[model samples]
Target chain A: MAGDRFPVEATHIMMFARSVADDNQIYYDEDYAKTTEVGHIIAPPTFVQSSAQFNPNYFLRPKVGQPWFGSGKEPTGVKRDAGGGGGGGGGGLHAEQHYEYHRHPKPGDVLTVTVRPGKTWEKEGKRSGKLVFSETITEYRDQNGELVVTARGVGVRTERPVDQK
Target chain B: MALKASQLKVGDTYTECLVEDLKRTQLVMYAGTSGDYNPLHTDEIFTTKVAGYPSVFAHGMLTMGMTGRMLTNYVGDGRLTKYGVRFTSQVWPGDTLHSTATVESVEDGIVNLKVETRNQNDAVVLSGYAAARVDS
Candidate 1:
């Protein structure tokens, strides 16, 4: 995901924390957060993934007046190839994710996102068919251009729907 | 409170029940917040009939986010310097998750940990590692 300004807001952080079932005051309560070592409210470890909300062309999100891939009057709004995977119909599934934090993001930090392709490889799987994996590296830098978080994500596309055990 | 390297040992571990019974609405919440509106995570008909799964499942990132709570609670908020994970298996509704962080080492005010999240059946859903700043 690439964007010029991904504003990290307090309410978004609160909702994101709630969705993950995290009740930590450091995410919501400023009073409690002030007493912590960070001395202020800080974003959760995986919170940067929410930057997808700022990605205008992110395919997973349905656009207005556009045919979405999800269900409507039928099982799906659009026709897809047969034998596609359960997650995204050859769009692939997330296989792995890694993050290195130069520092935890705070509420007011406006981050600039830059993405680059990493690597690709293939592996035969017992449960699924030919597994093709690709990686992407994303860097989140603060307004001052200091690297805040570096993220590496791997996605795998299967030959068909994975066989359930 | 942050962890102190002087008080920690290589084999020390901390665990938390991340979720008791996963719900589909929680998946919706995560999708809405994370902007990952992939139908597989929130659409039952599309998932079961079109994509071919028994039912809708949670996003791997959701599991990681929940597991992060466990980590921050152990190492203290804003203490983590590195965290990574591999999606081992699918997490479905009604599954309970338990996450653990085991201290692998502590050196020079830094602590490295082995992280793992298991379902109620003891199946590993997410496996990972993390590093954090600790008091000397």
Candidate 2:
């Protein structure tokens, strides 16, 4: 998933930090942040994942006037064939995520994101059945076209729900 | 404060309580902010009935984000150059998480760390590594 303009904002950062239960002043208080070595408010390390908010086609988000997979009356809004895995309701699980930061993003910086398919593989699992994994590499560049963050994400589709241990 | 290479050792470790009794509301907050509205994370009816899960679980990114808090707290703001993780297990509501970052090496004004997060059950939920600039 990618977006053309992922505008970094202070409020969004604050909310994101709160969701993770991080009370770091650097994420919210600008006055306190100025005393730090970075001397500015900085987004959390995983904040870039919020760019999904800007991705127009992000499947996880329910589009306006479109059918969502979440429950409404009969448990789900969308119908699926029995045992037909991999389409909606998250379809798969997040297997891994990696990030390389060229520099921490600050508010007012507009980022452009691009994504490319990486690799696909398969493995047998004990809890789940066969696992199919796919990778995507995303690049976030600043308005000046400088590469800011390189993110690699892997998603896995299992033949069945992972058997809880 | 930033970590100093001179004061650091290969085996030094830093730990933090990432979360205590993680609430489902926190998961909803994360899903709202991160734009990952996947039902498996917030819809119990859909997750349990449609998805066949025992209940809705926390998103992997949420655990990673909490773990990132621990890393940045240890290494300092804007210090991390690289961070990565593999989601080893599912995190459920009411699960308390603790994270640790162990100094793996100090070289050329940089520190490499091995990171791990575990639930109250002592199960590893996330495993990863991080690298950051350290003051010499």
Clash pairs for candidate 2: none
DockQ of 2: 0.75
Alpha-carbon TM-score of each model against the true structure: 0.96, 0.96
Summarize candidate 1's per-residue lDDT along A27-116 as a digit string, tens digits.
Answer: 999999988878999999999999999998787898898778788898888767532344444447899999999999999999999989
Q: After superposition, how far is residue A11 of candidate 1 from its true place, in Å?
A: 0.5
Give the winner by DockQ.
Answer: 1
Question: Please, what are the lDDT tens digits per residue for candidate 2 over residues A8-30?
Answer: 99999999999888999999999
**What CAPRI grade goes to candidate 2?**
medium
RMSD, each candidate, Å? 1.8, 2.0
The lowest-lDDT stretch of 10 consecutive residues in candidate 1 chain B is B46-55
Interface C-alpha RMSD per candidate, 1 decimal:
1.5, 1.8
Query: Which stretches of model 2 miss by more than 4 angstroms?
Result: A1-3, A81-90
- Clash list (residue pairs), candidate 1: none
